[model samples]
Structure formats: structure tokens, C-alpha cells
Target: MNKLLIVGISGVTNGGKSTLALKLKELWTISSIIHIDELTKPMNKLKYDSILDYHNWDEVETYDWERIKKEVTISSQNLLNSSRQLACLLNFYNLHEHHPILFIEGILLFNSPIDEIFDIRIFFTLDKEECWKRRKERVYEPPEPPGYFEKYCWPLYMFYKSELENKIKVDSSKSSNIPYNINFIKGDKAIDETLLWANKEIYTHLLNY
Candidate 1:
């Protein structure tokens, strides 16, 4: 069945998921994008000098997952899928008439129950050093105090990233891989070149439509 496509854009704080979502919205007039950060419950602002040597950045409790799922369901045309729906993505649909494309973006988009609903998953990453430097240039509302990146953000990102890599280790023994619409985007790469590659990937997926 032709269906609404849910796109997941995920990455650590300041990893450029928001920018990409905005651009994708611009590219597809029929698309809608949601930022989970906007729906997160307010928390005490981070302190400039507070140092936590270790923190579990993969904690799903940090986000309001229930509300996110509700909002996505309300906004989407959500066609019913079979109970035996494939556990893995077979492909993606880039466009459809009755069903609008939805892009859900957040730091832990993949960690929530909502993740399994996405037809496409895009991960954005930059070098650890680059992410640290960029954190200083970016500002969070309610305003994080100085040195927050050095104290918490950068370290947690790198740590969780390493863990994720270990979990997704490729199986060289398999003759064919399960089809999954996952893409890794390098933020430090040239924007023009990166967008071109992304466009091509989406275009290829659209061919299936």
C-alpha cells in the first residue's frame, strides 16, 4: 500500500538535525517537521562550571516520548499496518498525495517507541572536536551557562556515539543485508556536496514510489 512516510532525523545536541529538517521542509511543500526539544519539559539550565564526569546520554527518560507519539499520530494520516509488519525497513516512500511526509527530529529519536514507526532514519555527526567547538557558537534557550560543552555535552556525545557504533557493527558473514533506510551524514563536510548526496538518496527512494 502507498503510505505516509515518517522520517527520523537524530543526533546529539548541536549536531545540525534542525537545520536539515528545515531544509527538507523547504524542499518538500507537503512535508511537516516536528522538533522534540520544543516539546520537552523545561529543566534547570546547565551551569557553566558544573562538571559531571559521567552521564548516561542515552537515557530515554529525558524526552517526553508519550506526548511525541500522540502529536505525531494526530498530525499524520497513519494508515494501519499489519501486525506482522516487517521488523526492518524494506524501503521508503519520498512522496504521497493523501499522506504527508513527517520528519521527527531530536537527540534521541531512535531510542523511543516512536522510532520503530519511522520509514527513514538519518543520523548527523561531526568530529568530536568540531562538535565541541560548535557548541560554543550555538545557544540554547533559557541559555546554558558557560563551559557547558566542556563539562557535559561533548563528552556524552562521544561516549554514546562509541556505544552506538559497537551495537551496529556490520556482519561481514551475511550475503545480503536486511533493507533499512538509514543514512549517516557528516556535518563537517561541504554543505553543497552533502545536500547533493542526500538529495540523490531521497530521489532513489522516491523511485520506489
Candidate 2:
């Protein structure tokens, strides 16, 4: 049996990480697909309105850091709870004597403690302007406001990238300049094209190893 894990990372907003993950799911016979966005839904719902209000640093700072930390802590707890649910699902699959390739996709997958779990990591790189533009175009509902990216997500992502680059060997040959990255060919290319490439890579690295 062949087993593999894919972790996708990129800058804060939209860089097509989710799109690529979904595409990979379509291409591969993945036993389990774990998306961190799904895990963070509860936290988003809880802080949605508040986060919307705090679009700028001035507004975010108006609230005490301790209070913000409390909210974040609660959200972190929710993340952990969701992680447990996913873990149970994985364990169930494992116990059945069936080992299937798993693809766990997320923005922060390579950030901090979580990175230790994935066997392979891929980053989607895009310039800040391109990222923000893609995000704005994708927004069906209006986001908090301008400058939200800089005020919130960018700093966290910078910290994550800095730490991640130090931890793993990056494939600099790939166009995506993401910290530790692999470029999975995408776009209007035939599905077979992508699958052929991926299958070859997987067997060469995972099966041979």
C-alpha cells in the first residue's frame, strides 16, 4: 500500500491553496481529506462580527490584549476539538488494516507544531498585491475593510513562513517561492497530465523510500 500526506501553505489570504487541494483530491484516491478551514468554522462564526469590526489595527488595539487573547484561546480550543474529531476519523481508517493516502490542506499546516505531523509540504506563492487582489475578487460578501490583511493575517503568516523555512528543505526550482514548496502542475491541463506527474512523484519518493 502506498501512503502519502500533502500539506499546502501560502501567504495569509487567497493564493489558491484550497483550490489546489480540492483539485488534488479530485485527481487522487485520497482516503481522507482534512481541511483546516473546515476546522476553523466555529471560531470564525464566533468572532466573525467582532473581527469584521476590527479591520484596522487602531480598532483591534482598542480592545485589551488580554481580552483578545481569551477569545483566541477559546478559538484555539475549538481548533483542538476539531483536530480530535479528524484524528478519530484517521485512526478508524488505520485500524481497519487499510492504509490510504491522506491529504491535509491548510494555510498554517507548516506553521509551528502542526508542521511536525506532515510527511510532505507544499507552498503556494503569490505576491502580496496578487494575494489581496485575488481575495477581494473572491469576496461575495464584503470583507471587514481595506488594510485588514496587513493588520491581521500578514503578520501571522510572516511569522509562520520564517519558522517554516528553517524547518524543511525547499524545492527552489519550483516557481512557487513558498518556504518549503512543491509545485503541483495545475490549470486547464488534462487531468491525466497532473495525475501522471503526481503518481510518478509519489511512487518515486514514498514507495521507494
Candidate 3:
């Protein structure tokens, strides 16, 4: 089977991870997408936290990383096999070219087990103020409680942001041992620009491959 590249999109809430994933899917017709939200534990299973006084869905602990890893592994194999079959069928008709890239997008992909699964990772970020502004404009099924973003969500994201920065610093110091390839994207920029940046990274990796 040919190599299949896995790309991860993650970052702060309401920071446009989903939008970028959708756009990339449109651009890469054969690519498959796996959203982390689909792999989250059910709401009933999420106990309310004493600190937040609410079910904290923003943290890494809320997600099932084991399940995520399993699903990704399965999906990767499926996409690769499907691509091989498609290539054979297309070649029979005198056509060529099949690039099967898998996009795994989520809010907390930087966490353990999940982070190691990605060949390329893209993080979208915006200032807290901007994030709040855009978040307020959208609606969620499990409505956000009052002070949720200010009291819990934003703080948690900031914590993760700090951790990511520190990881990047450490990785930079060890040129030969970088564990990840994360591209930090400014979420406030134009969508087209962001798409171009992501495309460039993916294409560059494909070329190197």
C-alpha cells in the first residue's frame, strides 16, 4: 500500500478548526476527515467538576484518546486500501493520480497518544478577546453556561497554549528529536490565506515524501 499522510487540526475553541477541515476536504476530494468531536465521551458520562461547577468539555480528559487512536488506525488502513482499489480502477481507464490524505481535526489533539498519531499538525489561535467575540456569535447544542468561557474554557485553553509553547521550545533545542511538526496559524487571518498556508505545508510534506 502507498503511504497515507495524516494531518491534525487543533486549537482553541471556536478558532476555525472545523472550517479549515471542511475547506481542505473540498480542495482534496479523495481525502477523508475524522473529527474528534465524534469520538468524545457522551455528556452523561462527563461528571460535573467542582472547580468549574459544570461539565468541563474543553479539557483533554473529557476525550477518549484510546478510542481516538484506534479509530485513526482503522481509518488510515481503510483509506489506503480504498485508494489502492480506486487507483487500479482509474488506471484501467487510462487515468493516474491518487493521493489519500487523512485529516483528523479536534480541539485537544496536542494531548498524549493523539498527538503522536499525526504526521502534520496545524493549530489555529486567536486572542482571548477575539475568541470570545466569535464564540458568542455561535450556538451550541449543550448551551454554554454563564461565565463558562471566562471562568473555565479560556483558562484551560491558555494552559494548553502554554504547554504547547514550552513543548515547541524544547523541541527546537533538540534539532534531531522533534516529536511533532506543528504549524501555528493565526485564526483571525482571512480563510483563504489560512487555507493556502495549510496547503503549502501539506504539499511540501508530500513532496518530501
TM for every model, in the order presented, reads 0.73, 0.56, 0.90
The per-candidate count of clashes, in order, stands at 0, 0, 0
Candidate 2: RMSD to truth: 9.4
Candidate no. 1 TM-score: 0.73
Candidate 1 Cα misplacement greater than 4 A, ranges? 42-59, 78-99, 170-181
- Identify the candidate with maximal lDDT: 3
Sort the candidates on TM-score, descending order: 3, 1, 2
Say what the RMSD of model 3 is.
2.6
RMSD of each: 7.0, 9.4, 2.6
Query: Per-residue lDDT for 1-209 in model 2, tens only?
Result: 22334333333446555655566555543344555544433223333435556422212222233443344345445444544555576654322123234555556655534445445555655556766676677653334576567766666556666655655454454556334544433323454564466455545445433
- lDDT score for residue 35 of model 2: 54
Clashing pairs in 3: none
What does candidate 3's lDDT look like per residue over 65-130, in tens digits? Answer: 889888888888888787778878765321213577889888879865668767898998999899
Instruction: Judging by lDDT, tell me the better candidate of 1 and 3.
Output: 3
